[model samples]
Target: MLSVNNIAKKLNLKVAAGNKGLEKQIKNIDISRPALEIAGYFSHYSSDRVQILGMTEISFFERMLVDEEREDRSKRLCRKETPCIIVTRDLHAPLELIEACNQNNIPLLLTETNTTNFFSQLSSYLEKELAPETNLHGVLVDVYGIGVMITGESGVGKSETALELVKNGHRLVADDNVEIKEVSNNVLMGSAPELIRNLLEIRGLGIINVMTLFGAGCILEEKRVMLNVNLELWDANKTYDRIGLEHKMVKILNSEVEQRTIPIRPGRSLAGIIEVAAMNYRLQHMGYDAALEFNGRLNNQIQKNGGLNNDF
Candidate 1:
């Protein structure tokens, strides 16, 4: 949730009038132009949004013949649910409109930015501030220019794998707890909380600061999560994907990220496997699939030989 004063200060808008209602809450991310509302049509006026009055809207109101009509329109736009009123291009608000805003106790803000540019700016700011967020238990690391999240049961060596990756020149985004926000459709941005930022925990070894142990280059403030790696204990009865053709996914927030489950066992390097997975994911995105290429080669050789040979 954002208040009218919060956005005004963020966008550096000037307070033209209605200073008492700066604390009004802005619930909707969408802004309204109020062009039709200015033309005496309030059938579908979005009162919950921040009303923007550009040159066109101001001109329409000024062109009205009767003063009562203008006052009525201004009064209707400043309903109880309205968050605030903003004038673009530093345009002047009508006298009746200013009086209406003061009467309704709605904030009146002004900006020198043009209509189109201000719309883009305000929309971008609101989208980020009001985006949906969730907390996740995992370690997010940047490997091979990809955001790889390691998740599994406690003590499954997630932190250990992340430490190894950091030693290999990778960047650590978050440790143990990752706060993810859905900035856009199907895009998740993960970052560590303030208290645990740049800190890693290893069982029996206690907690250590990653930035202090390694250089600042090994720490990332935030990263866009692209893949999820789940580490599980090795179970002989369970079957895992041997070939790379099988695709798995996990949902985090509103995005579905590619998932890979690696079985943990002695003498097996988890960090190396995760590095290869990140690299392979990048390759697949670049239109190169190793599994498909190998399958195609095997099929061609079998057809050329005309039959299977078991003379070994």
Candidate 2:
């Protein structure tokens, strides 16, 4: 839960009144523009959001001063579990509104930004702060600007492969436990925990600091996860996708990411395979598919041969 005091500190909001209610918690990220509610239309009023009072709402309150029931309406609106009230454009809250807030212990905040700008900024901040996140056991590395997450069973040499990539000019994002957050609907961001950042745990060598050994360029604070590479032991019975015609995807935090499964065996250079995989993924993003091009050329050759024996 995000507290009103934390939001105030983050947004640089000034406490206009009701300082005692700073500890109020905000459950929802969406804010409210209480124009209709302030005008006595509370049928669909939302009390879970932070009420934003802009120029128009303040003007309405000013007009309400001529009415004999102004204080009653103001108190009715403030006497709910509304998170807080934010007055944009540095507009001073009317005495009635402030009194109502004090009476109900509802926090009132002031901001210098205009209504539209503040709403947009605060909504974005709240969305990010309240984003859904999950942790996965994997090794995340950034190779040629592509974020690749390596996953497999234990003893599959995931860390060793990541170390080799880091030695070859790639950057390590996280090792072992990777915290992934869905910042947007289709984007998943990967990062390491504070205690394990820039640290890699190898089988024989134990824990080693990648940043200290490989410099700052070999480590990244966070990266947008683009690909998932699962390394598994070589199985002769299971045929791998040599043609790369079939597309694979892995779901992470409700986002589907392109995935590749690489079979590991003795004498196989996993680091080289992963590096090429990253580059190939980037090429696919640029609308280049080598497998498709090869298949097309093969079909063209068969057509030219008049359906002759096309065995290659």
lDDT by residue for model 2 (225-251), tens? 999999999999999999988889999
Which 10 successive residues of model 1 have the least lDDT summed? 303-312
TM agreement with the true structure for every prediction = 0.90, 0.90
Cα error, residue 19 of model 1, in Å, equals 3.1
> How many collisions between residues are there in candidate 2?
0
Q: Please give the TM-score that candidate 1 achieves against the real structure.
A: 0.90
* Residue pairs with backbone atoms closer than 3 Å in model 1 (clashes): none
Q: In model 1, which runs have C-alpha deviations exceeding 4 angstroms?
A: 63-66, 307-312
- lDDT per residue as tens, model 1, 75-190: 99889999999999988888999999999998889999999999999999988777899999999999999999999999999999999999999999999999998989988989
TM-score of 2: 0.90
Each candidate structure's count of clashing pairs = 0, 0
Q: Which residue pairs of candidate 2 clash?
A: none
